[model samples]
Structures are given as C-alpha cells and as structure tokens.
Target: MQGFQQSVDIQSLISPLDWVVFAFTIALTAASVLYGNSLKKKTTNEKDNFLDLLLMGRKLTLPLFVSTLVATWYGGIFGVTEIAFNNGIYNFITQGAFWYVAYLIFAFFIIHKIKSYQAVTLPDLIGKMFGPNSAKLSALFNLFNVLPIAYTISLGLFLQTLFGGELLFNMSIGLIFVVLYSMWGGLRSVVFSDIIQFFVMCLGVFLVFSTSISTFGGLDFLKANLPTTHFEPLGGHGLATTLVWGLIALSTLVDPNFYQRCFAAESEKTAKKGIIISTGIWFLFDICTTFGAMYARAVLPEAESSTAYLTYAVQLLPDGLRGLFLAGILATILSTLDSYLFLAGTTITFDLLPIKWREKVSIHHLGVLSTAFISLILAYHFDGNIKLVWKTLGSYSAACLLLPVLFGYLFPGKISDKQFLFSSILGIVFTTYWRNAPLPGFYAQIDELYAGIVATSMGLIICRTLANFRSN
Candidate 1:
C-alpha cells in the first residue's frame, strides 16, 4: 500500500492569532528551561554537581515526578493518533489500556524497589547488581533505546506540517532547539519544561476534543458513522497484532525515563504515588486524544495518516485554538525529545564512562549535542516510516533487556553474573537476528519479541541447570 500523503489545506490551517499562541508556547517552554538553570544550587563536589545536574539533586516531589513522567512518556502523538484513526476503540485498548496495566504494575510492584536503590541511571543499577561488563552491555542497549531519533522524527513531521519545508531542514532546526535547552540544565531543564508543556498539551488536546465532539456528536455519532469493527476492542487487527502491542508495552519495566523519575523522587513513596497518579492523567489524556482521532477519521477520511490528528483539529478549531493545538503537539514531542536526549547523554557521560572520569568531568552537554546530531540522521533516513522505527526499537529493547533487567531486580543473587551476561548477550543476538532474518517456514510467524525472549530465557535456564548439575 502507498504511504499516506498530506492533502489538507496548509494555508488555512493556522491564523495569525494561532501563530501568537504557538509562539508564546515555545517562548514559555524556553523560559522554563532558563528558569530551571537559575534554580540550580551551588555544589561543593563534582559528584553533587553531577547529580544535581542530571537528577535534579534527587529531590523530585510527587507533582514534579508525575508531570515529567506523563509528559515525557507520550512523545509519539501522531503514531497514537494514527492508530486511533485506523482502529478506533482498539487504540484505547492497545495504546491506552495495556499501558495503564503496565504502569499500575510498575507502580505497585517495582517503584519502591527502584527508588530504594537510589541509582541515577539504569546502567548504574545494572552494574551494581550484575557486573561492569553487564553494565556496559546494558548501557549500550539502553542508550540505543533512549536515543531521540523517533521523537526527532515527530518534531520534524510537526515542523514540516506547520511550516512546509524539506524534512532535513526542519529536523535539523528542531534537533538544534531540542539540544540547546536540554544541554542548558539537563534533567532539571527537562522536568521544568515538562511542567509547562504538560498544561499546554492538556489544554491543546482538551480544546480540540471539545470542539470536535461539539461539532460532531459523541459515541452515538461514532457508532452510526463508523463500521462495527471500529467499536470492537481489538480494532480489527486480530489477536497477534494486539499481542505485539502488549509486548511493546512491556518496555515500560525497563524504560530509562521511568527509572530516572524513580531515582529522582524524594522517597520511594513519592515514586509509587507519582506513577499511580500519572497513570490516571494518562488515561484522561488518552480519552481526549482518542476522541479527537475518531473525529478526525470521521471528518477527513482521506487526509494523510501521519498528520490526520493535527489536520482535523486545525480544520475544526478556530485560528487561535488551532495554533494552541499545534503548540500542544509540538510540546508533546519536545517534552519527549528533551528527556530522551538528556538520558542518552547520561548513558554516554555517566553510564558508559569510567566512574573516576565521569566524577571529575561532565561532558553531558557534549553528549546531548551528539545525541541530537545522531537522532537527526536517523530521523532523516527513517523519515516516512516513523511507526516502523518505534516498533523495531521498542521490540528489540523489550525482548532483549526486559527479562534480564527485571530478573536482576526481582531475583537478585539468584541470577549469576555469568547467567545474566550470557542471557543478555544472547537476547540481543536473538532479537537482532530475528528482526533481520527470521527462521524459515512455520517459525517465520513468530516475531522478534517472542523469539528473543524465549531464546534468552532458554539460554539462562540451560546455563543455570548445568551449573547446578555440576555442583551436585
């Protein structure tokens, strides 16, 4: 099938009033970053400075944790909307419901344990529990996972849709902007910016959603116009595709953004409570976005799949409101971009680097710059296939790292260094191989997550069994 092409009237999408609102939103976001930097306290030692810069001095409260977590976690606004446009309520089940379950699971069973460790980065936790080798290997995977490539693509798409330009130019400018603010104050900047973005995003979506529903009725309208399959929970993709979404959701267990917030929280209780609260906010936000998507599909059935949400909102909302909605979409993307850029930098400057070197010098800004450039390249190469980019990366990370990381935390000493290392490497190999070249015939139906997870689990089991047998 041909990729979706933009057919919406770009000239009429925004008014001068909307431009002011959109510009104000951008200004507010940048101002918040500068303000965050000013809030940075003087630190006597390098360790204190590093922590203060990267983790907000490990003093995140419930509000800050929840806002930043919610803002950073949902960067794929267009992708989410695309699913909703295509599958209707199925978007709710796959993108919203399954993830809520994961969030709840993480909050209740895992948040306390994560916070108790007080580790700054996931690789640090991995190193402490496993070994240096395991830490470095995992850091490699984590860094690749946290790269802002997909979000950069989102920003590029946003800019292209709004300003009408070459993808490369929009992506470069967007990457530069994201890198500048991210490098300015690190995670402090990210969280502070997220605070403003969270509200803007909420307002933007709320306005568009309210307008859409007011213009077109509600569930009754959807049911009358949409196919019966649209009302189906699975959204007509069948069970296998839905299961893949669940596997993708499993990445939350090892998501660096989640762990970073957990480490940054003031107490274990804050982390748990913040996560629980964020899940609720996510649910509300999903309602707004999914509702908007259905309206978009109903109103403009032939519009570009990637830009349908924004195009429909722009078509329906007034000039200023259209601008605000665009701002919200931009904020959603920037929030995620800044967070991932910072985390990717930390992986380079803090996680992968030797402790002695990292303690003495901070190259986090360099790391941020580097990540933005690399992301720009990936975003360019994977310009049209943003969903594919997310799936490939998400599936690989979840399949390869999820079990080893989770087992490392839950079972602790039960998993040996050798077993963890073997399993993790095998998992990566299996995932990469499966993604690139699957087994022939009947085995081809099984995807990367299943193949990688099963291969890694079986390897770990066999190794442990052999070790036990030898000892006995």
Candidate 2:
C-alpha cells in the first residue's frame, strides 16, 4: 500500500549494462513504429483511412492478434505484483483464473455475434443494437473506462525509479514518447511494438522466477519464510471480498481492448483462436509473476508492497540481465498504455463525435492529444494507486454495460432501446449511490458493482414486462 515514490535508491541498483539493454529495447520499439508507419499510404476515402488507422485495415493475423491481445490486457503489471506481494497465490486466482474464464466466455459465445454486427467499436455495436442515444451513453462510459490512467501511473513510477526525478515529469516524458510513436502508425505500430514487448515481458518474468528458484529454492522456501496466510487460497480475505474480485474479472466480458482486437482480427476463427492461445500464455505468465512476487515477499518482507517485486528483481539479477528485466517491465506497461490511449482517441473520433463534424475534419490526432491530456490528469489525480483505478473504473463498466451488451446479443430484439438506456442509467445511479452514500448495515457489506448490476437487471425486467403487458 506504500506510494510509488519509494525512498530506496533504486537508480543506483541498476548498472550500466542494464541501462544498455533497456535502451536497446526502446530503440527496437521505435524501429517497429517506423516500420508500421511505412506500411500504408492515405487513400481518397475517409472511411478507408479511418479503418486503416483504427483497425489496421481489419487484417490482424493470428500471431499479431495473440501477442497484441495478451500484451494489452496485462499492462497493469505493477498492480499484479502488488497484489501478489500481499496476497500470494490468491493473486492468480482473482486476477488470472477469473479472467481466463471470461476470455473463454467471450471467445465461445460473444465474438461471432459481435462480428455479425460489423461494428467499428463497442459503442458502434451498442448503437446498432439499441440506438444512437444508447451508443453515446456507452461511449461516454467507454471513454472513462479506457483512460490509461493506471498504466500511465505504472510508467511514471518505473521512470521515477530508473532516472530519479519528479514523478510528474517522468510521467509526462513517458506519455509523450508513447504518443509520438503511436499517433503516426496507429494500431499497426501498437501491434508491432507489442510483438517485441510480448517476448520481452515473458522473458523478464521468467528470468525473475528462474533466478529466484536458483537462489532461494522454491515453494518450500516461500512457506518457510512467509506468513501462513500467504499460502491460503484467499490470503485471509473475507469471502465477499474475494468474490468481488471474481465479479470485477467479469469486466473482461465488456472490455474495450478485447472488443477492439477481435474487431481487428482477420477472421472470426482467428479472433477465437487468438484468445484461446493468449489465455494459455497468460496462465503461464501469471504463474511466473505471481510466484515471482511471492518470492519477493519472502525475501523482502518489509519492502514496499507496491514495488517489492521490482526491488527484489533488480537487487537479485546480474547486471546485464537486470537491464533486460527492467525493459520487459517497461514494455509490459507501454504496450497497454498506448493501446488504451489509441482506443480512447478512437472512441472520441469514431463513436462520440457528431457525424457532420467527423466528416468535415480528420481530427483523430486531436482526439489522441485530448485523450493523452485527460489521462495524464487522471493519472496525477489517482497518484499511484493502480488497484483503486482498476476497481473503480472496472466496476462502472461491468455494472453498467456487461448485462445489457451480453443479453442484447444473446436475445436480440427482446429488449427495446428505451429498456437498454434506462437499465444502463439505473446501473449508473445505483453504482454512484452505493459508492458515495452512507449505507445501512447489511447493504454496507455489498459491493457497489453488485448494487449497480442488480439495479440494471431489475430495470430491464420491469421495462420488458411493462412493454409486453401493453402489447397484450
């Protein structure tokens, strides 16, 4: 729970060789962006240009799809480490197992239906299913959901740890670097950069885990050194609290990044297979990260939980390998940050903008700039509490959109536009009230997301039943 600005001299722990490796990774990422930018020229048709910018011309192959999807989804790497440091294997269960289940659900039940809509964005699909008003409302929420605040904070923290400067200044520099590369090549650049980052991140965590095993032994070392609760499934948290994480994992069902990648995939089969393959990779990566953080916990029990894994890795690894690990962590965060920034910009340009205005000007760059500014502001406001950012934003998206979007697809035409809109509004109201208002005893124990989802469900049933009664 310690802030990201740790007092430890983290910069001194990093050697020159490590810096060389890190710089090399950044250089490679820049090269990839330049290559991606060179892949296509602007066409006469605005729609085609938009498609190329936003969806990579809907030509994402299986390998690209898997790498991009995996990398983008795991951007909050520091937050994952923080959870594992505090809660042990429960981190995998809450963050990993639940999300894997959600991924399977999306691949099997949702992707094909979404493809049938031929929508450019999640909000576009919402508009198609419900109405423009519904789409606009969903876009408003989606904008908030994809703010990149958490990843921005993670990047800022990483930079601060490396260069020893103001957190805000480091954050700004990192944001600018990503925007410079991402704005030109669009998702194509993001995808290509992600392919390199995907490998680096995997290797980084694997190196940490393997190094820990060699130095400190394995599970026996962890059990002997750490508290008994750390070995427990729930890590001593209450059942309700544990289950809420599972509910939060359901946010994956409504995640814009997943939707965007699926839309970008060359075919429905590619999308489905990509997710399945990515899940297996994610499972293995989770094992490395979760156990790696636990090793940190065991060795550095008194270190800052927010950064114990980083601290341990730098101190433990040899000079050159240490640099590579740091680069991997940076890659993990940058990959997610750029993708969300792009998505937020796309949402503004393609989904939120008035049609006439969009037709009159190519303001996608403006949208990206606007999103970067807003995300920087939010990242500053939240400081370094990545978990809070995730929980708060994930709760709103899951509570408001999950049921409506999923059920709207499953039982199309069964719910009217008015019903969808009202249900979503009800979810927002209930979530807001639950989060902000003082709740009476039993209600206080319930998560705001639970309240929001229940309210939305009730609204849907009431509206549908009333319409059916009137028809009869």
Candidate 3:
C-alpha cells in the first residue's frame, strides 16, 4: 500500500488551476471566520448563558439546519478519502442505504421528539427523562461515537497526498483555517460555512465525474477499465453483512447531530420538513459517490484508494474544478469536525463540567478553548488507520447509547434513574464482548445496529423489570 502510494508522483497529482481553486477555498473560509467573529455578543458579566451554551438559544432557521445536517454527515468518509481508505465501493454503497433510511427515521421519529424537549444537547433529552447524571453519561458516550476519529485517520492521507513533503505545516494551516470560523462562531459559523461547503462539494464531485468520464472517452472507457465487481450493488459484502445494514440504519437515530438539528429547527413542522429533505439529499449524494468509486477504479487503477476521487480531479479534471473538489473535501472534513468540537465543548461546559466551572466559563470562551484543543490534537493525528477507529466507535454507539436512548424516549418515566444507569452499563458490556462477530466479508456478517438493538432491548427489559420489582 505504501509502495502504491509512493509510486504516484506528487507533481503529477497537482496542476495550476487546482491551486487557484484551493486558494479561493482558503480565502473564503477566512472571510467567513472574520464575518462570524463580528457576531460575538458583548456580555457584561462573565457567565455562561445556559440557553446559548446548550441550543444556540433556539434561533435556528430552515436553511441553516438543513445544510448543517448535510455537512455533519458528509465527513471525511465521502469523496476521495473514502476511496483512499477502503479502495472499494462496498463500504461506501452499503452505508449509504443504511443512512438514507436512518435519516427518514430521524425525520419522523426522533427530530420532533428532541424538538419537544427544547434542550440544546442530546444529553439534555436524557437529562429531561432521567437526570443530569444520565445526560452526562450520554454525552460521554456520544463524544466518542462521532466521525472525528475517522477524519483524524484520513487527515494523514489527505495531508501526505495534498501537501506531500510540506508535512506538519500543511496540516496545521488547514486545521487553523477550519478553527478560525468554527471555534469562534460555534454552530453559527459551522452551519453557515457548511451550507457553502455542501454546494462546493457537490460542484467538485459533479465536475470530477464529468471530467473523468470525458477524459477517459466515454462510458466505454469506464466499462473497459472497471474491475470484475466494480458496479455490483452490494460491493461484495454478503447478505448478512449487507442485511445487517437495516439494523445499523437505526444507530443514527441516537446521534448528537440528529438531536442538535432537531433543537435547531424553528418548529415541529420545520424540523419534520428539514429532515425529510435532508434524507432525500443524502440518498442522491450516496448514489453518486458509489458511481464515483467505479469511475476511479476504471480511470486510475494504479491510484491509491484514497486518491481515487482526488486522482481523477487532479490529473483528469481541469485545474479550476480540481481546486473546487479539494475545497469540497475540506468542507466535508470540517463540518463533522467542528460539530464534534462544539458538541463536546458544550458537554464539558454545561453537561459534564462541575457547576462552579460551568458558571465561570462563557459560551464563547468555551467554544474557542474546546475547538483549539480538539483541532490541535486532531491535526497531530497523522499516523494510524482511522477507519477502524470509526467502525469500532459505531459499534460502541450501537452497544452503549442505543438502548438507553430508546428507553429514554419510548418508555419514558417508566423506570427510575438508577435503573436506567444500570441498563446502560449492561448494554455497553454486552456490545463490547460480542459485536466483532460479524466481519465485513463472509464470516461474521452482522450489522452493528442489530447488536445495538439487542443490547438496548435487553437493557430496557432489565430497566423495566427492576422498576417493577422495586415497586413490588
């Protein structure tokens, strides 16, 4: 793999037009950061505004919520970085369908539920149902489940390829650029920039696909160049591994972003509409990306898996479009990253941090400090294969949080807080021990979602039983 990566010449990977597009992206991010900083509220007393710390004071609109959802999901897993990691369309395609259905569930079932709570964080929902302690546990669980680890792993792939010999400074500059707007403006900056990024990402993918097909001469070029199972719908992961997708689809129902977007919506009707629309967008995006995997396999057989999308864009697409594609990739990465930073910051500040500290920390300061720390550490995450961490995190998500969330919402007020805590512990223990049974290929073809369902169901039963027994 290293040799294949080493074989590709960096000079061949970049062109002049790509530079202009890249520069423009950097310029735009900077401008947006400056624009967002000006929005900093002037506060007299040094105190955290609970509403601002939690739900952005519920001042969200339709477009902002919609775009943020798009950005939040895109992550480094999409576009070329995905190709770079898995090198096949299987993981990408299968996951897409799983997410599409999940998004619908989020739209109808979860979004309105969270909106009703009017809490800024998912933990807040838990806090409402159980107690502050349950909320704290939920935040800690979610802090690890996000795409940050995956993005961190892929950061190496992008920096080494995108900047090559330039090394640390290259990655640092990119991180700083994202932090500029994201750390300061918090969700406000994250959402506004994300909207633009979604468009930029779309444009980049569109141009790269068009250019690749055109350069290779036509469909015949792609068909001729493709691998044996290149266009296979399931990408070679068998029925169980693939079917497990159905269960896995439910995992996002318990995600922090899902909860956040629900809180961001102006009304139940708006949140409902926003989520339905977002799911539709996800379906289209996922399908197109699967096609992209095939195109890359055809055009750049020698290209590293991660470089598939970037390979076509940098070598095959015109320069200006190449730059746009890179910008889109950055957008995907930063959207997920900044969201985590903000969510995590809020967790430590409002949900998990001691009361005295929470009172002392201003929301703006909290956002800034947390962003800096996450960004700084994530930037240095130059080594290690990031995908495995993400997969593992997802498995953890299904195991630990899934059941508790289900119980929290569906069977609310049925169990004592202590009962819920014990159930969560049991679910996590069970998921940890048995989840690896399903491998990606033929063997343990389980979807992590079902594992989560089982864990949650068992936990719920235990919680209810305990509550019942206690009453008896």
Best by TM-score: 2
Judged by lDDT against the true structure, how good is candidate 2? 0.89
lDDT of 1 by residue, 1-472 (tens): 0222336666555778988998999899888878878878877887888888878899898888988999997788988888888888898888889899889989888876766566778888877778778788878888889988878888888888878888889989988877777776678989999998999998988998888678778888778767787779987776987888898898998888888988898888898888889999999999998888887877777877788888777777877888888889889998998899989988888888766667533477777777888878887788657778878888877887888778767777777767788887888888888878947996787788888889888877887789889889
lDDT of 2 by residue, 41-149 (tens): 7689877777888888999999999999999987899999999999898899989998999999999998988898888788888899988888998999999999999
Per-residue lDDT of model 3, residues 1-472, tens digit only = 2222324555566678777878788678667656654665666644434454345556667887778888788676533345422434565555676777777877777665666666767777788888876777777787666425455444445666765755455555655555555555566667767777777766766676566556556557655766645556565557765665455556787787777777866788877888888887876676556666666665556665655665555555555766777777777777776776667666666666676766444554564456455645654563444545555666666666776777667766775677667777776776665664535563244555555557667777876777688789
Worst 10 residues of 3 by lDDT: 1-10
Error of 1 at 152 (Å): 0.6
Query: Which is the leading candidate under lDDT?
Result: 2
Work out the TM-score per prediction. 0.95, 0.96, 0.85
* TM-score (C-alpha) between model 1 and the true structure: 0.95
Q: Model 2, which residues run further than 4 Å from truth?
A: 1-8, 359-362
Q: Quantify all predictions' global Cα lDDT against the true fold.
A: 0.83, 0.89, 0.64
Q: What is the lDDT of residue 203 in candidate 1?
A: 90
Superposition error at 83 for model 1 (Å): 1.2
- lDDT of model 2 at position 227: 85
Steric clash pairs (candidate 1):
none
